[model samples]
Target: MEKLQNREISGKQKVRSAEVGTDILKALAELSPATSLSNLAEHVQMPASKVHRYLQALIASGFAQQDQVTNHYSLGREALMVGLAALASMDVLKVAAVPLAELRDALNETCFLAIWANKGATVVQLQQAVRAVTLVTQVGSVLPLLSSATGLTFAAYLPEVETAELREYELQADSNHPLADTAKYQQHLQQVRQQGLHAVHGLLMPGVDALSAPVFDAYGRVAAVLTVVGPGTVFDADEAGMAAERLKQTAEAISWRMGYTRP
Candidate 1:
């Protein structure tokens, strides 16, 4: 019985140590490219002495380094390797699969995930709500860069050059498009990026409303688009609506899992 109690205490101590180590490591990353010992200790809310001991352990493990001259610390070789390995293993489709479904289930609206391909924002996966809508893009369908909530989300996050040629083509195809003027077009895209999501009424399909949000990767690039579609009246794709909030929340959750952190 005494041995069991001792083992339990030891296990608790190990877990507590692990948590502190992880917290200090996170503080190091946040304070990078380099920070003084005092600053790091303050950031982690620990005494300088306690933080230093952890830093020594981290440095020995190659997860941190201290500059000899400046007495500053930063993430080290092993930390960089671990970060790169994690990023390399992150797959957008695999990461987004469950969240995409949950987003649809939560809102009871059709939801889909789209990846930017050479062809443009293309739906790769979909979750249909029980109630049918007039129309929503199916798997493999390429969305219009200017007209779709999904496509506009991509255009908002992607580099202008990446979509410049396609924009001109889309503009020429539909001279009557809402985003015809260059000023309005740029302004609309800017709004989408600022809000981090967008909603359109019958833009993608008549009588349907769509809400779309961007899913970013570790490098802060738009890795995919998550969109929901339903009847205009029932869906009410207002940026302030329930659907919009859920859509953004789910997208952000997936982005977090993908290692994307906003500055």
Candidate 2:
């Protein structure tokens, strides 16, 4: 068995390593059905030779696999097994299930749970409404900090230095993809901070809108974000605000349950 070790590195070193790893993971995940080594290297802006080493490591450790004929890299069986294991071991899901279900029933929308990761925001848990429209994305999904309502809400509630670092990462991501512009991204973060909630429409999908609010921990710090998503045809601006308010109240309730108290 390959030993997986977590090395203690400096903050700067961690940033450099995680940035590279995130880029690679994003490339592989985006490729999904089919992806060649060269294609992944170009997507992540890394040399093919260097990326080969990373791929080899991933394959040897069962995080990824190469196709027999097409020579494409896809998520390995171990990756799926690990993902399942993660779901099984997630305490947050167990803790948030009943409350999230209640929130979903109250709002009649799809509820999502996301946590902060070194790369960006990682969706750890999910509870969908029976009558609500389903999202193409699901739990274990990783979204960029700038383009996601949950990410923006988390950033809005983060400390100054942490937010600044996120701003830099967003700008860099913007430079790579024309999908998200830097100036507008800055404005979006500002809106999140000012409004105490985020209601972004047509950002994730063509006809979807999401409203999110921050969930605090016992320390009064943002621990996670709770969001509700719905189709735009059924959800209008007013509905968005109502959902945001409801999500905010639900998040606060969860925070209080976690022993968070404001001075």
Candidate 3:
């Protein structure tokens, strides 16, 4: 079986190759139909040869369509077909994009939908603000469980043993860090599990703030974390608190769409 990991935004492979195949799919997704191969190579910074190989693989797998006239790439029919098929699957990633966009637009900040990996949080989807800011997160990236709202919320909801293991592996060991201690995070996780939400200030990146809430499946297992992240300057304490409440409500709505009902 392939292991899952949250990779940073630098084109590093933190997830399995099969999942990497999906990364290719997503990169292609964020493009106009019939993007030139040279453009994609420059965008992803891979050699054209490697890009061609991936393109061939994608073509073979029906995830990409090559234009005979333009000699460029478009999403293959099978890709769209599978995307439609995925609507009924357990994964909320494919189903959450529009809601995420709505959340981003409403909040005027970046939003993310993340799933639990064995070690940390894997960002399955993201919506960026139209205005430029300096945070370096993107779709298909991963963040440490102790450092971001998305990761912390997922960690808080995880089984105690698994949570502890992630802490042991991913949490920074320096005592000066706010979340460095196992016991402190255990207490924090208790609060999150109770309130059904989590918020952190300046944790993932200094001067940035984030709020997150879990999305649950029909069986009441957590499926993902819906997060809104912004700069602290954009959201002061009172405003951040309001956003947290909204995040919790939005997460609940998304959870309901995934078949989870609040008890």
Residue-level lDDT of model 3, residues 23-121, one tens digit each, is 667768767666888887777777888878878988998888899988988789899898666546846876677788888887778888888775468
Minimal lDDT window, size 10, model 2: 1-10
Q: What TM-score, over all chains together, does every model reach?
A: 0.93, 0.57, 0.62
User: What root-mean-square deviation over C-alphas does model 3 reach?
Assistant: 19.3
The top-ranked prediction according to TM-score is: 1
Ranked candidates, highest lDDT first: 1, 3, 2
* Order of candidate numbers by TM-score, starting with the best: 1, 3, 2
Give one digit per residue, the lDDT tens place, for model 2 in 2-102.
23233434556779866776577657867787698888988888899988887887789887888888899988777778656754554555567678888
lDDT values, one for every candidate:
0.91, 0.75, 0.77
Judging by TM-score, tell me the better candidate of 1 and 2.
1
Q: How would you encode candidate 1's per-residue C-alpha lDDT over 1-263 as one tens digit per residue? A: 99999999999999999999999999998888999999998898999999999999999999999999998999999999999999999999999999988887898888999999998999999988977444545799999999899889999989999998899999888999989899998899999988989989987678888899999998999999999998887887999988888889999999999998888
When summed lDDT is taken over every stretch of 10 residues in candidate 1, the lowest stretch is: 129-138
Cα misplacement distance, residue 238 of candidate 3 (Å): 5.0
